[model samples]
Target: MTQEFGSQSTTDEVLAGVNLHGKRVLVTGTSAGLGVETARALAAHSAHVLGTARDLAKARQATSSVLEAAKAGGGSFELAELDLASLASVRACADRLLAAGEGFDMVIANAGVMAAPFGHTQDGFETQFGTNHLGHFTFINRIAPLLSAGGRLVNLSSAGHRFADVDLDDPNFAQTPYDPWVAYGRSKTANILFAVEFDRRHRDRGVRATAVHPGGIRTELSRHMSQADEEALISTINATNAAAGLPPFTYKSIPQGAATSVWAAVVADGDAVGGHYCEDCHVAAVQDGEGLRGGVRPYALDAERAKALWVLSERLVGEQF
Candidate 1:
């Protein structure tokens, strides 16, 4: 591990002396942004990378550089089709991987949607909850058998989780008014809780799971936001920072954004990261109340809350792990 790694670190810098020649990693949403950079970094370290995306063609095109880098580094890169919003697609993808009998050393659930207009997934849950949390929930649990012992699961959560905690009673906003930020917050919190529960369930087999915040990065995940909305959000964030005597808000580049994911997955100690939330290449502290500068909220890492959500998720998905 790089003792100096922090918010400004890039994926390559964190992995400078690391070798992954025989490792196999599964990274979702490799069609763009941090996913692409993450896959490239791992592959460059000679790790076999199996990346998934909602659109196969798009993924292939986006990952061309990754493939070239892998070849040069004596690694490999491949793509699989996966639509997180569709249970059928998730199941099919898992089934195919199982049938192929290939095992993975790590799974990075990087695909997710950001703030968007109110909507539902094909499975009838709110869009953000479905695609960001539930979809990965069903998919990862189904493919649990494929993860080798000592393997890791890295769920890409967000600092936005501070916006709100999970609303178990109204996850779909059924009786509650829908707000994009709130919905996003709920799903991101679920991401952390999922990791906490999963780590508990699988640690006996030497498998560990953790959630990470990529910090703020400009990417396709923000496609749903209008320019005006984006400006307003940034202004608000900067204002909040100014009040706290902290520096103004700034976004990390793709490599910098992805550094934490790879760091948590490959560099950080297994025991230290298991069931924890990380940001800026290190485990984040539990923070509560207003203004998301960094750190996770307590509710997201509550063990009891994690267990309850797992039960609720199984009921919603109509299947148990």
Candidate 2:
């Protein structure tokens, strides 16, 4: 069936009449917001969902609604512990999944940290770059062997990638001054590049990867932002929109915010969407301006840059994938 869902499409709407009876899907950061909504919507279509959280108890509590939805849809739900800030925790999670020997139809790299004060991960990389990019990079690569043929990998990138491109020479900001938003942007850009290279390497094996920009939503991911930061962000957004001749910024409801992600994960054609950055349920155009509402930047999807970032990432993480 040919489907034409869009930015306003709800998760349930996208999956309406679709059957995922035996599909195995893994979604990270299920404790709240988009992750919870994404998992619930998939489960509501009878997909077996494995949702992760840094705190299992909180995840179980947060995903109670998901369990209820699963019950209603005759789906199943399970939980796993994951802390994206620690490579050790990432390895443990991958190890557990490996031991299960069960392959997934889809894997969604949905968990992340937003703009925060300068800090380092347990492995000593910049907090945002390490947790949002390298952490998922390591985990997904380790679990790549467990993806079923034709499986989909969805990395949740952001429109914030326009803030900065990946810095291959100093990804951790050891030499340069640390700027929270810039670091976050670089990490998000890495998310897109990771998907780009991943598609190139794995598409021949029937696996496809894509990055998604879930529209702006008032989620916990913004907990670190102070009032001043919020104001500055709004100003930047407005200026960018004005320059682009677009409307002022608007936020999506949690369900609405998750639409594109669910679309990329389950509804969109893998080959058509693979290696691209998507927003509003379609492959986004390349817009160069910073703080623009709805498109990816050219650098984010460059194949050569993707390859270079992959090599640099492997070296930084000290693991050859």
Candidate 3:
């Protein structure tokens, strides 16, 4: 079964017949783009959605857009605070949710920063690794109890994982030269490793985890890259497309890009199979080429590496689950 969808599928299409009237869902980075769309779609299906943003004000603004969409489709939404760069913020957000004692049926670790300038987060870790991986790691650890039985986790990774593997020796770039793209690549790979380990450790507890590469889409994720870098990437993509006898287009719309993440998180069929990397709404076939479409790299899917990262993450966040 080829469950792969194209760049034209909307959230509603991806979720056409699915319903979650009483299920609680949490979406991070809901201020815009794919995150906002995911939240809107879930809310439209009557799933209680808590969309997290760095600030409540911005989150509300984002929620308003989802609310408008939900009004037409029939559902509701709420806002929460989550600053992936700050462990304290992650703790606070988890605490707030836990205080409500509202168990969530799903958690989408969706908020992420892309190829930004070299910098350290409040935790003294590379910004991409810190926010995209560590933040979600800490949040999941803190909210382990809140994940209702049979809950699922969606870690949004990227095709960029092909560029590099998790640099356990220098995750923070503490002693190495920092290349923003490399850092982003490693972080994306970490996202997959996270799911691999999360599933390994938590499947027995009735929680499963997955990682997905929602195909390339135009979004704020590339904001930090210079025009030249983007052009170079586009050029590379175009060259590859041309070689494959395809068009020059390399990006998809927000809704199209969000389809796979939505599929992995909410699809009833997905519950039986977790810890796999997905693309276009289905478990990705392990690829082999090094130039373009490749399988999850050995390191990215390594159980040992995933476990090591999990241990390191627990130490950093002072939380264990």
- By TM-score, the better pick of 1 and 2 is 1
* Model 3 lDDT tens row, 59-114: 77756878886676566788888899999898898888889898998999999999
**How well is each residue in 1-321 modelled by candidate 1, as lDDT tens digits?**
537689999999999988999999999999999999999999999999999999999898899999998999888999999999999999999999999998999999999999989999998999999999999999999999999999999999999989888998999999999999999999999999999999999999999999999999999999999999889988988887888788999999999999999999999999999999999999999877577777889999999999999999999999999
Q: Which residue runs does candidate 1 get wrong by more than 4 Å?
A: none
- What order do you get sorting by lDDT, best first? 1, 2, 3
Candidate 2 lDDT score at position 184: 91
Candidate 3's displacement at residue 88, Å, is 0.8
Q: What is the C-alpha lDDT profile of model 2 across 1-321, one tens digit per residue?
A: 287877777887878888999999999999999999999998988999999999899888899999999999989999999999999999999999999899999999999999989999999999999999999999999999999999999999998898899999999998999999899999999999999999999999899999999988999999999889888888888888888888888788888888888888888999889999999888898877556577889999999999999999899889998
Weakest 10 consecutive residues, lDDT, candidate 1?
Answer: 286-295
Clashing pairs in 1: none
- Ranked by TM-score, the better of candidates 1 and 3 is 1
lDDT of 1 at 139: 99
Q: For all candidates, what are the clash counts?
A: 0, 0, 1
Question: What local distance difference test score does each model get?
Answer: 0.95, 0.92, 0.83
| TM-score to true structure, per model | 0.98, 0.98, 0.93
Poorly placed runs, candidate 3 (over 4 Å): 1-7, 241-249, 271-273, 292-294
